[model samples]
Every structure is written in C-alpha cells, then in structure tokens.
Target: MAREPQTRAETSSSPLEPRVREALGQRLQELSYSFDEMVLRIPREEMVECCRLLKTTPGLDFKLLRCLSVVDYVDFMEVVYHLSSLSHPHKVTLKARLPAEDLRVPTVTTVWKGADWHEREGHDLFGVLFEGHPDLSPLLLYEGFEGYPGRKSYPMPEQRELYGE
Candidate 1:
C-alpha cells in the first residue's frame, strides 16, 4: 500500500516501523523515540551509560557533546545535552529531569572530554550536579553565594529573604 509522507503537526498518531519500535522498546522502553528526530529521554539513572552507548553505537555516532545546559522550572530541573555526529552530520538531543533535592547526573566527560567545563558551567548557574564531572564547582561564582542565580525559584535574596523578611 502506498502511504503519504507523515506530516508534522500539533498531534501525531502514527504506527511505528517494526525496527524502530523494537529498538525503542529495547533501549528506552519508558519513552518512545520520535522517528523524525533521534530525541530520546535517557533514564536519569542510566544517563551516563546512555552517553557511552551514543559514542560507541553504530549509525547514531554522537561523537561530540556540543552543549550541556539546563532549564530550571520552579519545582524541578531539566538537563539538556546536544550531541552531533562528525561522520553523519546528524544531531540528537538527550534530556533528563531531576528533582531539586538531588540534582545530580553522571558526567559525559568519559564519552566526550569537552563535557568537563560545560558541566561545570551548568553547576555554577543552574546548580546541576554532574556526578562524574571532573570539576563541579565555581567556574565563575565566588564562595558563600546563597543561591544558584539561574534557578527560576532563586530570586535575589535581597528582595525577599535578606531584607524583606
């Protein structure tokens, strides 16, 4: 049967290719991968392992960890890792959500040596903790700073805690 190219839209209800569905089930059962993009959620506990696979896996050769940044929602944090493949010229995004309590994730430095400083910068501003990051402290901020400036919940203390109350 002839089928039209799927359209990108506000809502999608499409059947998966047998292989993609199988791979998605085998690797990341919790999240179904988008066929249009390789975007997938690596389980929080398996993040480091997933990055290791990304580097070594065929076809999805995400050899470079180009960016490590974060999004700070008031109640939680989302870590974004943008990776690119030198050979394939393709890209993938991996995201993990962590609670504010234990805001930690394993480092990708072992997979991408460039991740060291990117993780550090994330820790400095947004307070993301890269578990195996070589250096996770103060790339810019000095000691005794009360809060992570970039967190949405982190209002300037002078306005609320220090002077107001």
Candidate 2:
C-alpha cells in the first residue's frame, strides 16, 4: 500500500504541541504563541539556543532555515525565521524581537550556515546587528556608507548633485 505525504500542518508539531511547547517554554522567557499558524515569539536572548534545539530535536527536526527577514517598526524590530524539517515533513516559524536602539541578536550561522547572507542583508537594510556573525559586512550596500539607508528616518539626499540645482 502506498502512503501519502503529509502536509506541513499535518506533520508539523503545532505551536500548541505539548512536548515541543513545553520544551521551549522551559528554556525561553516572555514566550507567546499564535493559535492560528503556531508561530513562536521567542526572546532575542534565547533565539540562538531555541533555533539550535528546533534544528536538532528528534521529533521536531526543523533543520532547514528557509527564509529570514526583518521588519522595522521604529520602536522595535522583528527578526523572522522560517524553518522546515527536510528529513521529516514539518515546518515552523520563529520570531525574535529586538529593541530598535540595540538592534542586536545572536548569530544563527552556527546552526545554519546559510544565515550568513540573510544576516548581512538585514544588517545592510535595517541596521540589525548579528553578534558572533563571522562576516556582517553590507551585502547590498557599498562600504563606508553612513546610516542605514533603509530606515524611515534616513534623509533622502537632494538630487542637486545630479540635477545641478
């Protein structure tokens, strides 16, 4: 008999899963869960450890870090990580909140080498610093550029240089 592959929702340990949720709750602080997608809002200090566990845990093997993105809300920034279980058939989203002033989070490159460029891009655009990142140089911006050009407060330079105004 042939078996069917499970959808992410089917195979994934829902954010509400007792075993997974309990394990995370014990290690992390200020944790919150969304009932719908089961996205976890992990504290910035615990993100690296949580990510490592999510990647290594047996039943909750969230090995692949598929996407990384950041949202700047002026007062705070959110770093979102989309993880998938390649060996098994599951997925999870982990979010770490960082203060706008500090803008620092532990590097997850050790857990997933591919985080290199993603962290760089975030640093380039949002000025989010990934502590312990081997290379946090700007990925899309030229070196020596001042201010994070992507921030809302960054002034838009006049076109006088090009227009001769």
Candidate 3:
C-alpha cells in the first residue's frame, strides 16, 4: 500500500514557533523556519526586550542561551542568538541587524547572564558596542587593538602596505 502525502498542517512545526510569534507580536521584522528551527529577525531596538520575553514567557521558556555570535556583512552586522528551552524540546534563532556606521545595541546580559562574554567577544572583534554591557573587555583580542579584525573591511598588513595606510 502507498502512503498518503501530508499537508502543511499535518507536518510538525517547531513547538516554539507560535508561542514566539504571539510573544513578540508585531515587533518581529521577519519570521521563518530553517533547519527545523524557528528563525526570528528582531529589530535592533527591540532585541533586549524580545530576549527578555523569550526567557521569561511561561510557555515559551527559552531559558538557555546556547550561543551568541556576530556576522559581518561589509555594510552591516548581524547579531545572532541561539536559544533553547530547558523544559521543552524547542530551539530558536534570533537575528538583529546593525548598520556599519552604528554598530551599537543594548546588551542582553540582563536577560541571559552568559551573554556577557559573548558580547565582549563581539565588541573585541567586530567593534560592536554592546551598550550597558557591564564590561566590554577584550575576550579574544588584546587591549588597544586598532581595528575590528572580524570585519571584512579590516585591512591586512599586505593591504595596508599596498594602500600606504
């Protein structure tokens, strides 16, 4: 016997998807599914508050901040946060964009304490300013490092020599 095809509703979505949508409401810039996980694009201004809701919301308890990382896109930077729920089988990725000229966003350390070092790392390498971060100290780079090495625009020694910079 042949099996019947499943419709979209018959397929399972990440359990956290609806809860996240309801919690964030119109603040979310975009929402989609990738690799069996829910992805939310949050505005930079709403990042901190969104993160707080993700952690504190009853049904959408994203209590574990798995990782935080930055992506340099030449003209802008994308901050990505991977969060998981300890009490539920759910995970979500949140992204916020920061313009190259203003690489600043409020720290999420208030929501997840583990974000402290991650923010520091972003600040050290991407020149991102995590405002209100307790200590934006060096995580992977030495103090007094000149440019944001993580950015694509960071001139290498050869490039600097070629350009006489």
Candidate 4:
C-alpha cells in the first residue's frame, strides 16, 4: 500500500480537508489527520488504546460515538467506529479488520453509551461479536436468523419467480 504523492493544492486545501501532517516529538514520527474523511490507520493491536485516548484527551474530545458498522471483503470483515466531539466537532473513524473465521473486536460501551445499539447492529448485520459488550443480543433481527443478511456474500431469495434473463 504505497501512498500517493500529495499535489500542490491538495497539500494546502482547507488544512482540514484531508490531513494536516504535524511533526511529532520524534522527528521521525508525524501525526497525519484526514479532515474530510475520518479514517485513521493505526496498528490493529493498538485500536483499543487509541480509542481510549481519543475519548479522554482534552484537545481531541471525541466523546460522541456516532456510528459503528461492519463490512465484508471476502476474506476479512471490517468493523468501523465513527466518533465525534460536541465541543470541537472534530470526527475520527477507527477501523479493525478481522478474519471471517474470527470476527470480533473490543467493545466501546464503556467509553460511549451510544455504542450499545451500534455494537448490536454490527453483530446483527456482520456477525461481528464484540468482546466485553455486556449484551450481544439481536437488536433488529429475530433470534433464529441463521446468518447476517447484510453480507455481500449472502444469497437473496427471490420474492417473484420471473426468470427471463
């Protein structure tokens, strides 16, 4: 995954349009932020810690959990969490991809109460179980549903029998 080179205008748009690259304490490290899209690419193992910091850090102030969902990419399933701040209105997206065989991630119910139904929705739609979720019951679908219906690989049953392809 090689990153594309930044153009002149892209390098100086809204300053918050894509990312504002700021030098870290260590010259070798820099913090990059995406303004338009709230995507963050932190290491998989550090996902929980990063979210914890975002919730507690004064300047960051990402106290609101806006959305949580999952997507399937054949071999893996991605769980995405979107957080926003009421004070600063800054937003961030946190994502974690787990193999289809083991689809689970750390729950943020402790950080944001809004995570309750969002985590349940993720589990209901993508079969992504959440660790420490307290309750993993179905939020939308009935209990006996065999599979997650939102998956791309899911087979759709024909309500109408017209076959004239």
Q: What is the C-alpha lDDT of each candidate?
A: 0.70, 0.78, 0.85, 0.67
Give lDDT tens digits, candidate 4, residues 10-125.
22233432222231111212233354544555544556667777777666667888888787776777777888888985676666768778886888787787889988888887
lDDT of 1 by residue, 1-165 (tens): 222123243324223223233444555533333554455566688777777777776766678888888887666777878888899766666778787788988888888889888888888898887886776768878876767888876666466655655
Q: Which regions of candidate 3 deviate over 4 angstroms?
A: 1-13, 156-165
lDDT of model 2 at position 102: 91
Candidate 4 Cα misplacement greater than 4 A, ranges: 1-35, 158-165
For model 4, give the 10-residue run with minimal summed lDDT.
20-29
Clashes of each: 0, 0, 0, 2
Q: Which scores greater on lDDT, model 3 or model 4?
A: 3
Position 107, candidate 3: lDDT:
97
* Candidate 4 overall lDDT versus native: 0.67
Predicted candidate 2 versus true structure: per-residue lDDT over 54-157, tens digit per residue: 88878888878999998776777889898888786666678887876799999999999999999999999889999999988778989988888777667777
Question: What TM-score should be assigned to candidate 4?
Answer: 0.74
lDDT of 3 at 146: 85
- Candidate 1: the clashing residue pairs are none
TM-score of each: 0.74, 0.78, 0.84, 0.74
156, model 1: CA deviation in Å? 5.4
